[model samples]
Target chain A: MTKKIFPSWIAVDWGTSNLRLWAMDDTANILGSAESPLGMNAIAGDPKLSFEAVLIDLIEDWLGAAPAKLPVVICGMAGAKQGWLEAPYCDVPARPSDLAKGAVTPNVTDPRISVFILPGLCQRADPDVMRGEETQLVGFMAQNPDFAGWVCLPGTHSKWAHVSTGMIRGFRTYMSGEVFALLFQHSILRHSVDDTWDDASFADAVRKASEQPTAFLHSLFGVRAGALVAPVGASVAPGASVLSGTVIGAEIADVLGLLQPGENIALIGAGKLASLYQAALAVHGYRAALQDGAAITLSGLRQAHDTLISPPQET
Target chain B: MTKKIFPSWIAVDWGTSNLRLWAMDDTANILGSAESPLGMNAIAGDPKLSFEAVLIDLIEDWLGAAPAKLPVVICGMAGAKQGWLEAPYCDVPARPSDLAKGAVTPNVTDPRISVFILPGLCQRADPDVMRGEETQLVGFMAQNPDFAGWVCLPGTHSKWAHVSTGMIRGFRTYMSGEVFALLFQHSILRHSVDDTWDDASFADAVRKASEQPTAFLHSLFGVRAGALVAPVGASVAPGASVLSGTVIGAEIADVLGLLQPGENIALIGAGKLASLYQAALAVHGYRAALQDGAAITLSGLRQAHDTLISPPQET
Candidate 1:
């Protein structure tokens, strides 16, 4: 019979709601991948055994019967305190490569797999924390070694990081996305907002909110009040765009103070939210170069894995 | 038996969530009062019949056997388009007396009562509307006729009106109260906030948010983040006061621009919320005189009632 070859390791992006795994070879190329909704939050009845069972259930085929111990690298909320095993945060003003140094290996009964959970980052003075995004940041830096300015990773909890000389200086998080969702779905404005999008209404709201940032509190109610008094044409709602614009505009106006005049901005992530951020930035005359978050996350995980295999001094 | 005495007219303050009735003398004194949870929003089936049923259920005894048709002066959401009858809005830059002119009398099945639903005020230029609060505004002005600055009525949807020379020149509304409740109980910050009260934290947050209003978005997340990495001493949650402070402070900062350097401010309402607004203003070196919103609502209903009893021109 012809000899068979197997993948070298596995990479996992385990967050609160989803689990994604990638099989990689010695060349760091993806050989195969698998995904499941069983994230860190889904583990029950003895976390260690549950996690091991879930992992084995998904990738048991790749493990083969009595195969050599495979290195499984993990990132995101799986390293949280309430997660499988805590990999404490690496403080700010540190290199992304520092993630591996703080990573922790959890004991596994399955002889074929060895798991390593990567550490997140934390800023003590300002009190901010990030899990999976740190890996993405490292990947971005790995691609553009000379990049120095602001990197915005937009999501449910949007993060804005300041980077220079291969070090993450500091960062701030905004709950704008979460707030928008809450207000749109739960607040009194719910009666006046829906999935509608109007570019003109959005642009006007962006400008007005930027001009008078303090007016945000007052203007928020205007979305409902405006729709009540003079709704858009035939539709009952005129606020869907205005609500989104005001939120994004308020975020931009606040973060503007952190940027230098004409500073370089790289926006990471994909889909409609990222596009909205890009459009919002353009509203302020700023052009942001977009980057793919998935690719960067993989690159960052590989960087950590490489570090784990060979210490910098030994290499 | 001596001739039994009864109220000449019944004053009603039927809002979105509650229906309040007061047996008033000709001088606007409340003799007997009754209230029910069935406000305009609670009416089911035929609106006219449902509303009449709810009103008669609560105040039927007041309308004794063989009573004459008593004037029932009603205010608030009862006049909303979706309520008993659509009483259109009275345009702003109007006198308190204007509410009665725009009032529409809804036909009632009961011959013992003559119903008049007072109209709410609307600002056509800026597109703002108020149902019950407009009555409270008129009441505030009635108590302090010389007061000509800003009237801050804080509630679920807070209203700020600019009054000068016995006319409401303009006004704005903020959803600060609603936003606070949502964030405190529904958002991610819910995990880090509760009913805990910390005056120092509240005041400090007020000062910071006031000085940097644009930072409100970023600072909001900081409340959750701050709790995570560095929680308050011995408490898992340290954000209750900060959340309230940030919301109220942002409102104060935004409305500050609308006021002159030494403008007078009258805050209408009761309980902890009103106190918080008062404290937030003091952080900016402004003192807001507190007024009882319940008393003011009654006074406003009386004003509208007086208007209905005797047409200003006819009187």
Candidate 2:
């Protein structure tokens, strides 16, 4: 008798504005990857039908002749109230096991396709919450068994989590990125700097922010005057840098002040944003280790899938 | 010999999105105030012509006279690069004396009119800047001779100023109000709350924010989830309050942390926004006194006009 082997399940991290998909073997090695702009927000109503069409089309393009009955697990904003299938929120101090055991409704369109949706985690005492990053945090925990302390996932809305004993003890979020975009794009100071950061301006802002953190907002208005009144020349990069640094630096100071000295800081995100956070942390005397969010999500999805396929004894 | 006295001077605060005109008597008491949707931005080109037309139309109805000419001092974004005439910027720690000594250009269409367009202020070391608020700040300084420390002007783009020894030494702008609007009107959290904040929700948010200042963004996400997962009869006020509190509280915390302990904080602006800033400051152990924005602007404009008309001090 020949035994049949289904390689492994797929992992998906779909958010409000973007989508990321990965195909991994049983060992969680990613064999292929795909991305699209069809975020949940773009396909909220009638998502079941729309998502199926897009998913099927993408899968056919990627796997070619591969069948459509493969098992898959998804996380992030794609499972929110407005997502493809409203995956209800899971309460926090949530763990990998908790997320793995969380409830999920079947995809209405495809009964043959077994899909597991991860729920966002929320705190009971405070108004704090996390959707997609919790899954990535679980993946990070799976990779580093003894990891503890804070993990900051920076993006449009950055999340800072306090993890201990393999559970997300607590977390906070900062609208640093959004604030930066609005100020730079929509506010009066937009003309202060031409869309890029000047090294001198950036350095000065960082230093000033660190020193006179209270004067942050007050200092922001200086950008416009510096450009128009003082005739700072065409190089508004310094001004832009200072604006960016002050906000980010203020966030760092707020976060660091909340944490004790020598607390471990892990940064999980991608590209320039992650680097900026890393640099800001370093400026404030914190050593933040980097982690790729995509990798962590894949690992986390696999760990969650394993928990479901192999049910362990509950304590 | 008869000394001439201008019957009325038109005080205009022309911003990007709204135009406010005040008919002021010799003493600068606003005899009548009028607002129109015809802002500087609405007039794509020939701002002087467009502005003159709008002002003439609005005033003709009130004054019952043919509107050929009127002495006016315009401030705010109308004096921007895209404004009627770029009023050029002034160096920071700007003072009434500096504004008094600032330059003015006559209207291109009506050269007989001496229009004093107020200049924005900029900081030498940072990218921060401000425009119309300089006039308002000057007005505040005129009223309170001993006023020093931080003056927070709340608006779409909130400004925090360091006023010492009658000089606007430094300031910073926070996009807090604008962020609140964008998040509630445009971002993912828009659907979480109703248009207004109820008592419970507002108080709860303010309290939570004061306690856990860092968890602001995380708390914001809870607004949506709370509405979804909570009891059907659950009040949406808490969710909205949480959102409001998080942004406002975080801003207050950032500003307070930026300033020295026990420094005097003055809340300057008009209406509900100023009151909100005052409330936020009170929450953070600072009693912020309120100053009327319009009154300040008028005083500042009067001072500026007086200075311009006075003879220059010889070296």
Candidate 3:
């Protein structure tokens, strides 16, 4: 009996501040996972260096006894302008196939390693763009073929995309995480509350922001004075929560306001961030579905790899 | 004629992070001025030491030559809950006379000094409050008795107040300055530009933010990605300008949106901050009247001090 040897595929999602890698079987089940701090930002100036070196350091034990040659598909800021190699931006209303068909540049120093780089997605309507989330969205769609409407991936630059019939129609980004961090760390409000968001305060802020949406800008400044003048009573958590909730509520309101009524919304990503978006959407009277970000990215990378191996038959 | 000697009033605006002193005649013209880094924050927890030592060190020569019993009216965060003394907060919609009527406590160890600490102003709306700016606003109103409108004092926590019928009707705070610093210093957008604001970018971001106001949240995240992906194209001048303009523009849009149509706005501050507020207001189709912050604070302090010395006649 002849032993059947299956090809092992690797998926990598590298961003500005962090790097994540996944090892999967031919069927795309996760065999192992590895991550590192060696993000694209860590080695921006030098593009010729192998990102694989960092990856190998993180997961050499996982690949124990495996052959040196392995096929890997990479996405995100790793292919950005200052990333390991420039993959360029794919203009808007982009597709999964657009990413699959994008260029692949082998590491100049290592021929055994084939690196398929993914292109970023951009739109002209609002000049909105994304470098890696599109692949995750594709992966998300592959798992739930019937899923449609809006998919929101919350993060430093949170993305809200319109997905229908397997195509990413359009999307927008919100700097919620960065704004929250700025207010909490650098603003006078930093003196109030503990590190984490207080639930009661957050809920109160969400309610206030939703009710008086127009006062978001005016309310943000209160964070500082509230702390200075009334520290004991004025918890930074509520003030920050209010500032964050107002800005985010305003953004969600603006985005949803533009959409036609009855447009479904799906919340992606993980933990507090995704919950915040989900809560914001709910506050606005929208029923949004939730998706696991890790699952979406893994599925998306596998689908892209499969499509590349065997081109889909045209309808 | 018996030579009349006017009581020398030593005005000190002491706060957590700064200390400013003014030697004034009975008429309130400045004779000599001094400032130092010995703000309240610089000496918060130490009880054994006093700001008096730092004050005397900075102005020993002037103090020795001037009256031995000069009275000082202190304002700002110097009298906050954690300040040298806790002066407490006065409820908002406060009048110049009301501010003057606020309480002060003499220094425990210094019998030669009569320190009248100014109280902060608090509002029921969002329970927002402020301290030093109220005194400054009082000074502003004292300087321009006929002026009435929305007075915006831009800083770490920008304050926007409605001044009508000689009273501050309502006020709001916006974390514009802190947001600007965070985006410039810590975020990925730092490399996109210098501190200079380009007219074109400022106008463009303001216009964009005004039209799609929610974009402010998303555009903030762009600061990071912009630095990483398109650092070369992100015009440093325009980028910084846009970052500031976007926050200010969003603020204006929210504040204006809350107001009844055709409401006038006035900006009170100095230098770049004042100009930014002025330009932001203009983008929203409102021409702001400018007021000097220093002049206002000085005038307000004088008015408050005068009221403390004189009782109002019953009307």
Candidate 4:
């Protein structure tokens, strides 16, 4: 017989295109988990009703009828101005665990649910902001308290953070991932590029882009022009790989310039993207350790939950 | 009564999306002109039949019944592999007038027309090619035979040609225009950007991009982040302007590095794009002269016609 378990609280990661949930017991162990495609960008009607309806539909089993209110901690774009509630950005260098300090609570008519949205992190000097990645940073620091160096989270908008002693020093976001998607799917390069692996071509492109970053636009055009004129003797097409290398290489070069000779570097992601970044980093003569992104995010949300349940002593 | 006039020759500029025709008199003056939306790309059927049909449809009035074969000099995508005829690329550093040397003739049963599609210019070393722009270069050279320096053709695929002694020394293409369009219309930045001019904001962004060219993708993300965290108090939105400045500045920075301090630069296009390039150049402490694109193209076609009618004696 399956045992009926009720969660003490819930964790939500609502981003632009996805809404993920984790039901956790008091001990911070996940009892159950759920996900939905109803991301922030998909909600066009009432934000409050829509978000509540989606949340309730996904976790109805966890919410006992007319039971005492269960706290729900949320992160990501769900805290933006256009989200369920606007959670102001906390400027760095600030502790990732302190995300709850600037968090905003949203009003809910459902007696079973109480929602608290975590604030994102921003760099006032450089005009940069992160909605969901800050929580991941919090989770990462919790796992590696003594860690002091760079943490890269590669995705649609790849983010790199400088952390020290549990505080996020500063961060920068690169649109390379989104740029690559747009160029491959929409730009003139679409005609020439195809899914194919060419390690030599990719490495050569990476080296070229890293060495002469300024000539990036010129090099981008070469992707299409090269296919038209040169047509490399590869069994599979190399344009796609070359394009990927060029983009990732430029990002690496920019970040590499900011860093000194030796520094601890870790990538907070998994799968092909993480491997690609690791390969790209190798191209730049740097080694980076990999971390589970989902785990780090959960750890971050748990930190926020702990803060909510046990507010710091009046000091 | 309307006077009927017949042309001595015809000049055609058939690009990927549009087909243009210019009926020229014996003195190289335009007698009448026609245009059609059936460009090279629109013709999916047999190239010979489609091209001939489209040509007859647009210039039927110019073609009299049982008339002598009229010479037609064509340029641009009409000479591409998928075009009406494949006019092989002539390698640079080649004189623009020498385009006709590699021209391909397409057989026609129209009885009233004879066609010669001019070849494009390609740089084998750099792997760059220009179709319609080469014809414009030829025309520009015909007008200013003594001119030598840099010629900038700003468009979807901006081309910068280094010219000296009536030959295209080399050329480079930048897809900044297409990239700007793709980003503004499809990228996440679309939510933040709008069409409003802010000269100061634009200039500032241009300066930043020009200074740190490698940090382009990072700076691109800044457009959205800046709007989100720190909304500027300008009467109109500055995100769009900032985006434009950032893209154009990067291009100028890349090109500026290749050019000398005193090299004469002329932009070979009119209206907003040319003006924008001129404004962007001014930000880098340089001035550029603008030329009418259409006039230059007509002149180039005239030169090709002259070459066809009166072949230079072999030395």
TM-score of chain B of each: 0.91, 0.82, 0.86, 0.92
Mark the regions of model 1 whose C-alpha exceeds 4 Å error after superposition: A1-5, A44-48, A56-70, A108-114, A231-238, A311-315, B1-3, B44-70, B108-114, B124-126, B231-237, B311-315
TM-score: model 1 vs. ground truth? 0.89
Worst 10 residues of 3 chain A by lDDT: A1-10
Backbone clash pairs for candidate 4 read none
What's the TM-score of each model vs. the native?
A: 0.89, 0.76, 0.84, 0.88
Cα lDDT tens digits for candidate 3, A1-315: 533333376788888888888877876677778787778878674666457677656555544345665667888888887777788777667667877888466464444456788888876546567888988888877876676677888887778888877788888787667767776776666665344555566665666665665555665655545554555754345555656676577667657756765567777777877888888787767767777887888788888787776679755
Residue B249, candidate 3: Cα error in Å is 2.1
True contacts kept of 2: 0.29
Candidate order, DockQ descending: 1, 4, 3, 2
lDDT of each: 0.83, 0.71, 0.72, 0.85
Best-to-worst lDDT order: 4, 1, 3, 2
Report the poorest 10 consecutive residues by lDDT, candidate 1 chain A.
Answer: A229-238
| Cand. 2 TM to true fold | 0.76
Cα misplacement distance, residue B242 of candidate 1 (Å): 2.6
Candidate 3 ranges beyond 4 A from true positions? A1-5, A8-10, A14-72, A105-115, A144-148, A195-197, A214-217, A221-251, A285-289, B1-8, B43-48, B51-70, B107-113, B195-197, B222-237
The whole-model C-alpha lDDT of candidate 2 against the native structure comes to 0.71
Error of 3 at A313 (Å): 3.3
Docking outcome class, model 1:
medium
Error in Å for residue B275 of model 2: 3.7
What are the per-model DockQ values?
0.64, 0.28, 0.40, 0.63
